[model samples]
Target: MPIKSIKVRLGLLSIIVLTGTMKTLGQANDTLLIRQLAPVTVSATRLEINEKRLPAALTVLGGGRIQIGQPQLSLFESLGGVAGLFAQNPDNFSQDLRISIRGFGARAAFGIRGIRLVIDGIPESTPDGQADVDNLDMGAMRRLEVMRGPSSGLFGNAAGGILNFQTENANEMSLLEGQVTVGSYGLRSYRFKTGVQKKKFQYVFIATRNQSEGYRALSHMESTILNLKLRYDFDSLTRISILANYGNSPVADDPGGLTLQQATENRRQAHPNNMRFLAGESVAQGRVGITFEKTMGKHLIFARAFGTKRDFANYLAFQAAGAGTINRTFAGASFQYQFSQKFDLIGYRFRLGMDVESQGDTRRRFDNLIGERGKLTFDQLESFKNIAAYVTQELTYQKVTMLVGLRSDAIRLHATDYFLTDGDQSGKRQFSRLNPSVGISLEASSKVNIYTNLGTSFETPTMSELSNNPTGTGGFNPDLNPQQAVNYEIGAKTYFSQRLRTDVALFDVEVKDELVPYQITGQAGRVFYRNAGRSRRQGVELSLNAVLAKGLTLFSNYTYSDFRYREYQTTTGKFDGNVLPGIPKHAAQAELRYFTPVGIFAIAQVRHASLLYADDANAVTANGYTVVNLRVGGQKTWGRMHIEPFIGVNNLLDAAYFQNVQINASANRYFEPSQGRFWFGGVKVGIK
Candidate 1:
């Protein structure tokens, strides 16, 4: 069938389905309009407040929204409709996944940078502002929140923005659940979850195993995850909580990028060199955290501590001078207290907090001889430490609320080389800064809110970015500097009708000493960074959610970005006013959902992006494309057990496009072909 005809048929089908739904269920406005009152949030300012009253560009995804497409494997599945955020590379497990908020994290080669990730109120991002989301157990998550724009004044290092994930907790009941899923390309998954809640103690536990044969050659993966949460109530006013998580991935294969010619010839085939080198990675990680809270009269006090350990090994397609083994440890603690008081018809609140973190890595490199370690080539120890103190005040008068915050951070980084045959190389560097922010929100009406804010943020280079510098000796790059930016933003949220909600934001950002990465010649898996002089970023984001009829809902979001380099001089030439690579000029997402009283649901979605450059010089580019997806499921109950089944189809249009790209890559090998049309189905059983 022709692509155009398919698109037309899909549109007609949507209209027909919606019409039938309205006719069957009629206009049930009262039921559809029944929503939770004043959803509470903490990511915007680290204080629990109504989301509508927060002065920031924020998005929240609950389990209902995230579980629409069952058996979730990647964050991209649910977050595609969030404006100003981009998530890709779901199939490339070797590089984990790529996520950028307003173009801040686009330059990362592996893991995530320039963004803060918090899980269950504990920082997952390291002291140097780097994190890997691949090991997170999505099955254990209950909600996620995203705060876009500069936020260094609130958080600490690399606070370009914030991403927080909260796990499921025990309620006032006990329950057990299990799920099994099978899909195309040998995909299989099994999960078990349980929760118990009592007067004095409560607990939640989940475990999962996943394996995939992959859509492309040499891209298979297998992993297991476990998550546990425990809470004890000392009294009505005091409590303690503990959390533990572990993940192990015995194998995650890497297919490597393909040149344009290779992609055109055979998109399914892996790079020829990958099979010989056995390119892949193995990882194991564990984490634990504890939290204590107490409330005394009008004051609240809280404290938290966490620690993590990780072991990693990898084999690259090309042989160089390293062993691919790494051992890392991270520890952190935070303390805070707040008091609220009112005077002369005005209410005020003040909070004081401190945070400290330390991280260390023991990295080793060895020669690769046909997928096996040959000879030890390098050994080193690298560490980063950070300390920060902050204070915030909030004042409320009438229908307006005002907030101000100030924070100071001190960072220290050091490196030690143990392979002294090439001469001992040791170095250290220190950085310090003060960040400030101010914001105000006005309640335009009962259902409308207007907000704006001004803030400053900073992002430091990750350890990987400071390694193997081209212009300096091999310790830490002395020439590299932190990127600083100032942001001005305005936004509004309104409910035009009982069933319609919309949010819109506009922002202008100015950045200095931006860090940019370039691939070195003849280096297959190595990357270096340099500080570009200046840049400007401006954009608009809009989102909408509406209940069109009794059982049908509509959701849509759009982002328009205008980002450019003000001054940049590269080794090849001077390229000024060039469009930033890796971000689309325009991107959009739309979805239609149908739900019935019989526990049946269906969703149809569309995602589109405009053209994007692949290099800083704008010499190469990737064409824009659109894709469609569909999901359907139903549930049945018997006695105390419930059974559910689901099916999904991805890339229904069978569009051929690139799913991931290596920006500014050498040898012109940039494209990672997307998986074609695929289907999956699964069944689940639970008891409550």
Candidate 2:
């Protein structure tokens, strides 16, 4: 089916649903426990604010909603309800999870780019705009804020969006907890957590270990993580926080992608090349960060500093120099000041901030001799440094609020080659960018809000992307430059009553030098990057939450994307107007939650995605699929201890689906079969 037809059908369906549900607005509010709905609060824009008052699209998830009766494996498990966000490859730890917001991050070959990642008020992404989620601790997650759309004015490079995560702290509660989980395919997990408060000090700590035999051959993994959060309060107006995280993954084998026929024959089989070369990855990473904030009357100050180090090794399915290792160190700091004043009928607040960050990588490549490292082939040191300053103003008058932001960034990229056999390839690249954004929101009434915004963002190619020079063996790919975008968006939030809430957002974006990925023949697993001349991305997102009855709740969301290349040409082909690969045109999710006064809870979820193309040529398509999942759990208190047991069944209908698709893969190896009918059960013991 054509994308236009699908869009039309979805439009009709949305109208019908909205119209039918809104008819009941004339009735009285029937919320049983309105106070328990947990209103969403957003802080991704550098300040704590009400969602309805913000001029951007945002989604929030509480700790229980994200962790309860969940596998706690990857972000894919927690991000299902966020519209316009697509996540895949949950089981492929070697590549991390492929996450794309709107269409910005669709080009990432490994880890994440085109988006900003924040953890406990500190940046988690590297200076060059690359982030890996293997170190994120799902067990300690407290609140998650997903800010969708361009935000470069506030966050600088790769700010197509922001994902801010705040973990649990002892200030909220004090507890000691332990959990053990077992599942199919030789799965085992153990977690221990503790939180305590002493006088003005509070701390929360968590440790977890996970092991899996995987559903595919040669795809086993074992990893351990530790997280610590500490905070001190000097009265209510001043505070300091410390966050530390460490992760070690000794083994994470990769089951290389397969062709459709190969997957159809035996989905569990690993690629022959993968088995021959022992494809996989190992990562040992750690980071420490500190944040301080002070407020006095109408003035506020904030500061943050952090450092991270990573030792990584990867083995691919190809032979000649297909293995690589990177010893990376990254550090950054930021400071901000805010002033507020109130007039007779209007109020305004202003903020000024500055940031400095740097990243250095000692990278080396070697031949993959049947999973063993061979002779060294290439060696280089790559570094990226950044300095930025930004200013923002927020003004309010009656029921109207306006926001304006501007930022300037300076960046330097340098690399030094150690392998002289290919001649000296050292080089440096510099860039300076200025970005601006403005937005306004109107409280039409007590029950509705209308908002609109225009913003621009940029994403510089990562050090890894520049080092993989497609044309020759070199230190940096001088041709690979930064990608820029302009986004215009409008949205509305409505509350029929205490029982129903709905959000609708529409966005249009134009991109220049859009980054894209492709694989060269004979380099089956190695990915190369290139630029598309121009592209246009437009999307409609809708989400709703309803307290259907006393103990039942309904939540659902849908995303419709129309992304295509406006003018793009390459040696392989001319993709003047092709549907962007790796993202479905239509994606939707529906979840039902049933809770009783007794302490028992049940959840049923259904997820669907329309078929999407796998390559720029649009000659091959990945079939769409629907997956159903069910979870049930109950809580019981026993004196000073609370015991909770839960079980979950994923893909209840045993649907045939692809967990991941390697975009523009060589030899048409694009499919990674998803697991079928998986079951997991666990028990948690906690004391408060």
Best TM-score goes to which candidate? Answer: 2
Model 2 regions lying over 4 Å from their true place: 1-39
Task: Give each model's whole-structure lDDT.
Answer: 0.82, 0.87
Indicate which candidate wins on lDDT: 2
Q: Give the worst 10-residue stretch by lDDT in candidate 1.
A: 21-30
Q: Write candidate 2's Cα lDDT for 262-344 as tens digits.
A: 99999999999999999999999999999999999999999999999999999999888889999999999999999999999
**Model 1 Cα lDDT, one tens digit per residue, 181-278:** 66767778898989998888999998899998888899999999999999999999999999998999999998888889999999998887777788
Q: Judge candidate 1 at residue 391 and give its lDDT.
A: 90
Residue 176 of model 1 has an lDDT of: 91
Please list the residue runs of candidate 1 whose C-alpha ends up more than 4 Å from where it truly belongs after superposition: 1-39, 172-174, 471-473
